[model samples]
Target: MSIKPLYRSCDSQGASQRSDELRTYAASLIPTLKARAAETARLGYLPSETIQDLEAGGLFGLTTPRKYGGEPVSTRAFLDIVTELGRGDTSVAWVVTLLNVSTWGAATFFGEEAADEVFGGNQPARVAGVLTPRKAVVKKVDGGFLIEEGLWGFNSGIYHANWDMLSIPIVDADGKVLDYGFAMVPKADVEILNDWNVVAIQGSGSSSVAVKNLFVPDSRVTPLSRSIGGDYPSTHLADESLFRTANMPLAALVLTFPALGNGYAALETFIASLPRRGIQYTGYSKQDEAPVTHLQLGEASAKLDAARALLTSHADALDTWAASGQYMPFDDRAKVRRDVGFAEKLIWEAVDLLASASGGSLAAATNPLTKIWQDARMASLHGFVVPNTNFETYGRILCGKEPGTLFI
Candidate 1:
């Protein structure tokens, strides 16, 4: 059976205008988010009101296909929204990023039946995914595969999603491995585990999920190879630029934006406190009056700016390739991984500098800077942001050697 595509193209000018509107809307919510940051942390997840606000504002569907009542905004616009949200609260931003990115992935890779099940309604669907395979048991059936059992951890935003995507290893009747694929399962079929307790980004609700003997139809599964190569299942949306984006690079890049936002928030928090803050017996009435403070602030600002530059540059490059209907080369993808990691490093450095300069006062749990600092540190520890791995991969690629990783 042939499946119809669910996509509509917007002119560049129209898309940009819509993106600006979304950005403006996201910016307007920062104050409210900042006000509820502590409460969100306390709850270990985003407040219902905050989730409703984001949903009503269409932030959750930023990258969804327009046919599904989504804005389907540009990558730059998506990044801007994420960064702005992160500036308010990293936890909220991280959850939103994970939700939106997973939605985008579902739209791009899932078969039409699954896409319709997810995005066919009046409202946009919230989707979350964990790509890392965990205790997955795949058994082939006549029509689909029986996922007897599976457990995926670090499933950010799963608490709020209507659907979840999980990685599975495909096997034949003989139990020989065939390929790695993703399965789109409804939220009702899975069990959420209370395992999200963490010191940073605590409100993200990134917990573990367990599935027992779930049957997924073949139409809803997508092979990792096809997604990585941009050979998506949604032929109806195949012509859409955003859907054509390279999957692995997009995954690597989305994880970096929250860190960027956290960095910006840290800088702002530190600067705002400088007027009344003292240097702790350094003979300075205000920390801002000290020359050393000036140097530290300037250095942190520059580092953050550099990180933003790298992030936006790579974002634009990805968009350019998508819009031009060209595949992003492997080498370029490797460089993007390296650039994202480097950007993360710079963001963390800026946060650390600002936190150190703010002194022991920031040790208070109530201090917003403390949360931002902790969030940045924790976010930088993500696999995608590991400096050594990315740098080594890029170096290997440059040296004409194979990058030992699959998700280039």
Candidate 2:
């Protein structure tokens, strides 16, 4: 069950060289991932072989601390690797992104003992969790807190994770809500309800998990508000800049890559199929020979390019702030939220255009384009990345009003 690091002496390699090697490794898995896409969907989770391939590639540790033999890759580098994986299969890419993002959050915010428990082992840790608490009850105890009872839904990547980072509301002796914090708990302590039947992103296996009377030590918990404001408890902040980046912006930006990947794959799939297909009821024997086809392809490609530019810019900004040893300001973070939402919207629009231009044949369940379109649309619907909500929040901030959500 132990997973070894991809390269033992990664410190000897330049950042650019290390990034390129990781991206190349992800690209090399596309063929195998594509071959299993159908099986992944049918099973409602990534196949075991796909998980093994990712582990061998050292992808799970992309966001892990170097002390634990992880890369702690830059936000931009992590985004690039996820995009490459997305090109292979959006759901598979999505799961990997969630695992890494959760791992990053855990390592950055929680105490060192918690980090060691999760990532210090020979086997790389995959953490899956949700920020919202549902039906949760907590109580103060001698050394820590007890869950009492709780349920957290949409636990993406839960199927593969050995630990979970759950959000909970701290309470006083009178049961009055004191503060909110995240609880690090072993997966074995919770009950997983495998009810993630959905129309899109089926392979993500985002099932619900429940915990009853669980005891969480104080060392495994971290305050939520301070962490969101860029104050963390991890001692690595002095040496590692990656842990200094703002949390919300990084979370929002990472979700958008799945859509970007779908756009890339959809465009690739449509272009590859164009030469052999004919325009229905038209004079043109080849779809590629038609003027309308050119327009559609042009528009889709342009949208994708714009999305990539926006997402990359947002990531670079986070890196810049992290390097400067400053927390990203509220207004800047608000803009990041807006940018991520818009980027996903553009990607969804692009994929939809490609799907439409491909004709009715793409409606088939067996077609890759069909899944790509569905997954892209699903990515846009996420609450954190929704275009309308994010746009409104940014607009509010611009109008000298509150962003209205703590998530920013």
The C-alpha stretches of model 1 lying farther than 4 A from their native spots are 1-11
- In the range 361-388, model 2's lDDT, one tens digit per residue, is 8879888889888898888899999999
Runs of candidate 2 with Cα error greater than 4 angstroms are 1-13
Give the Cα error of residue 312 in candidate 2, in Å.
0.5
Prediction 2 global C-alpha lDDT:
0.86
lDDT of 2 at 159: 91
For model 1, residues 212-280, the per-residue Cα lDDT tens digits are: 889999888888888888788887786678888888888999898889888888888888888888887
